[model samples]
Structure formats: C-alpha cells, structure tokens
Target: MDALIEKLKGQIIEQLNLVEVKPADIKPDAPLFGEGLGLDSIDALELIVLLEKHYGIKIQNPADGKKIFESVRTMAEFIKSNGKD
Candidate 1:
C-alpha cells in the first residue's frame, strides 16, 4: 500500500504537470482537492484519465469519482480492491 501510494504521488504530479509539487510533499491521507491540493474539476478529469491510462481501472460510475478521488490513499485502496494494484 505504501508503495502504491508513493507511485500514485508521482503519477499525479506528472499527469497534472504540477511542476511545483513533489512526491514527498503529498500526504497519503490528505484530500486531493479543495483545501488540500486545491484541485478543481479539470484536475478530477485528468485523474480519471490517469487511473485508466496507468492502472487500466476505469470509473464506471461518475458519482463514484467523489469517493474514489478523495485522497491518494483512497485511490490506492480502490485500485487494490479492484485488483488493479
């Protein structure tokens, strides 16, 4: 799980082109949006693409995106639950 979380931080930074962010700067349990990373809807869309492109895990229900993208830990857990990690 820790490995997955670390890998995800790298992916998120790279995919979002967050030049100012580093993998070490992200807290696994920190929220990915709002007061956390300050991500918006567009960043959410990019995250969706990131999941599918990297893990082959697709978000079948758009509503689930809220729960799934809550944080790096959540995303890693989701991938593990789906056997994608």
Candidate 2:
C-alpha cells in the first residue's frame, strides 16, 4: 500500500502539474480537491480518468466518485481493492 501510495503521488504530481508541491508534501488524508490541495472540478475529472487509465478501475456512478476521490488514502484503497494492477 505504501508503494502504491508513493507511485500514485508521483502520478498525481505529474498529471495535475502541481508545480509548487512535492509528493511527500501531500498528506494522505488531505482534501485533494479543495482547501487542502486546491484542485478544482477539471482536476477531479483528470483524476477520475487517471484512475481508469492507470489503475484500470472505472467508477461508473458519480456518487461513488465522491467516495473514491476523497483523499489519496481513499484512492489508494480503492485501487488496491479493485485495480487491475
């Protein structure tokens, strides 16, 4: 899980183009799409695609998207449980 989290952090940093932040700077439980990391709706869409593209996990329901994207920890857990990797 730790390895997966680190890899996902790197992917997030690259995909989001988070110029000012480092992977280690991201708290696992940090709010990734708002006050904590300051991402917006478009970034959320990117993250959703990222989960599908990289992890081979598709979130069909928008409501499930909320639970899946709450934080890095949550995303990691989702991927770990459901990812093709």
Candidate 3:
C-alpha cells in the first residue's frame, strides 16, 4: 500500500504536470483537491485517465471520483480493491 501511494504521487505529478510537487511533498492523507494540492476540474480528468491508462481501473461513476480521489491512500486503496495493483 505504501509503495502504491508513493508510486501514485510520482504518477500524479507527471500526469498533471505538477513540476513543483515532489513525491515526498504529497502526504498520503492530504486532500488532492481544494486546499491540499489545489487541483481543479481538469486535474481530476487527468487523474481518471491516469487510473485507466496505468492501472486499468475505470471509475464507473463520476460521483465516485470525489471519494476515490480524496487522497493518495484512498486512490491506492481503490486500485488495490479493484485488483489493479
């Protein structure tokens, strides 16, 4: 799980072109949007694509994204539960 979270930080930074954020800078429990990473709607779309392209996990419902993308830990858990990790 820790490994997955670490990998996710790197993937997110690259996918979203967040050159300022390093893997160590993203806390596992920190929010990915709003005040945390300050990611907007477009970043969310990129995250969806990231999951599909890298983990082969497609979010069935758009509403689920809010929960799944709560934090690196949650995203990693979602991928793991979906058998993508």
Candidate 4:
C-alpha cells in the first residue's frame, strides 16, 4: 500500500502537470482538492484520466470520485480494491 501511494504521488504530479510539486511533497492523507493540493474541477478530470490510462480502472460513477480521491491513500485503496494494482 505504501508503495502504491508513493507511485500515486509521482503519477499525480505528472498527470496534473504539477511542476512545482514533488512526489515527496504530497502527503498520503492530504486532500487532493480544495485546500490541500488546490486542484480544481479540471484537475479532477485529469485524475480520472490518470486512473484509466495508468491503472486501467474506469470510474463508472463521477460521484464516487469525491470519495476515492479524498487522498492518495484512498485512491490507492480504491485501485487495489478494484484489482488494478
């Protein structure tokens, strides 16, 4: 799980084009949106693309993204639960 989270931090930075953010800078439990990463709606769309492109996991319900993307940990958990990792 820790490895997945670390991999996710790099993937998130790359996917979101967060040039100023490093993988080490992202906390596992940090929120991906709002006050945490300051990501907006468009970034959320990018994340969905990231999951599909990298993990082969398609998010069927947009509403579930809010919970799944709560943090890197949550995202990793979702991916693992879906047997994507």
Model 3 lDDT tens row, 2-83: 9999999999999999998888889999899988677999998889999999998887787889999999999999999999
Cα lDDT tens digits for candidate 4, 1-85: 9999999999999999899998888989988887857799999988999999999998888888999999999999999999999
Q: Which has the better TM-score: candidate 1, or candidate 2?
A: 1
- Quantify how close model 3 is to the true structure by its C-alpha RMSD in Å: 0.8
Q: How many angstroms is residue 28 displaced in model 1 relative to the true structure, after the best TM-score fit? A: 0.4
Compute the lDDT of residue 22 as modeled in candidate 2: 90
**In terms of lDDT, which candidate is stronger, 1 or 2?**
1
Q: Write one digit per residue (lDDT tens) for candidate 1, span 3-85.
A: 99999999999999888988988999888988856788899999999999999988877778999999999999999999998
lDDT of 2: 0.84
Q: lDDT of all the models against the reference?
A: 0.91, 0.84, 0.91, 0.92
Candidate 1 global TM-score: 0.95
Clash pairs, candidate 2, are none
Off by over 4 Å in 4: none
Between 2 and 3, whose lDDT is larger?
3
Specify the poorest-scoring 10-residue window by lDDT in model 1. Answer: 31-40
